[model samples]
Target: MLLLALLEAAGIAKLGASIGAGIAAIGAGLGIGRIGSSAMEAIARQPESTGDIRTNMIIAAGFVEGVALFAVIVCLLCLFL
Candidate 1:
């Protein structure tokens, strides 16, 4: 991949990969945190809609986690291959 090539040329492929993975994890954490915060606020505002808010929050968190996992896997591959 072009990205790999560039990193290799710069002699920091492993470092880059590690940093990328860390960033992905941090971003996911932030995204999930925001989702939870918003969901709680929404639930507080509308107690009767707790079920809907919780469901949407979980779904959004799952999506963010999935993306983070994919990013981490890609970074690991880049580090090893």
Candidate 2:
């Protein structure tokens, strides 16, 4: 509410882009944290599968990061163009 009021008062036209980038970054961070936490739990349960768990975690993290990066880039484009 406060943010909306501020933006409205400031008459910022690119607020949507800024908000989109922020949401994407925040979502990616949360997603990566959850993936890491789960992988750690799995590894703790099965030490023998540590390698597989770590590999899968990295792959999943990479995908999340890639999507976040794309979102941020699109948001930036919207802001600039």
Local distance difference test values of all predictions, in order: 0.94, 0.91
Residue 2's lDDT within candidate 1 is 89
Model 2: pairs clashing at backbone N, Cα or C within 3 Å: none
Q: After superposition, how far is residue 29 of candidate 2 from its true place, in Å?
A: 0.2
Q: Say which candidate scores most in TM-score.
A: 1
Off by over 4 Å in 2: 1-13
Model 1 clash pairs? none
Cα error, residue 11 of model 1, in Å, equals: 3.8
For residues 1-81, could you state the per-residue lDDT of candidate 2 as single tens digits?
Answer: 778567656757388889999999999999999999999999999999999999999999999999999999998886775
TM-score for model 1? 0.89
RMSD of each: 2.1, 5.4
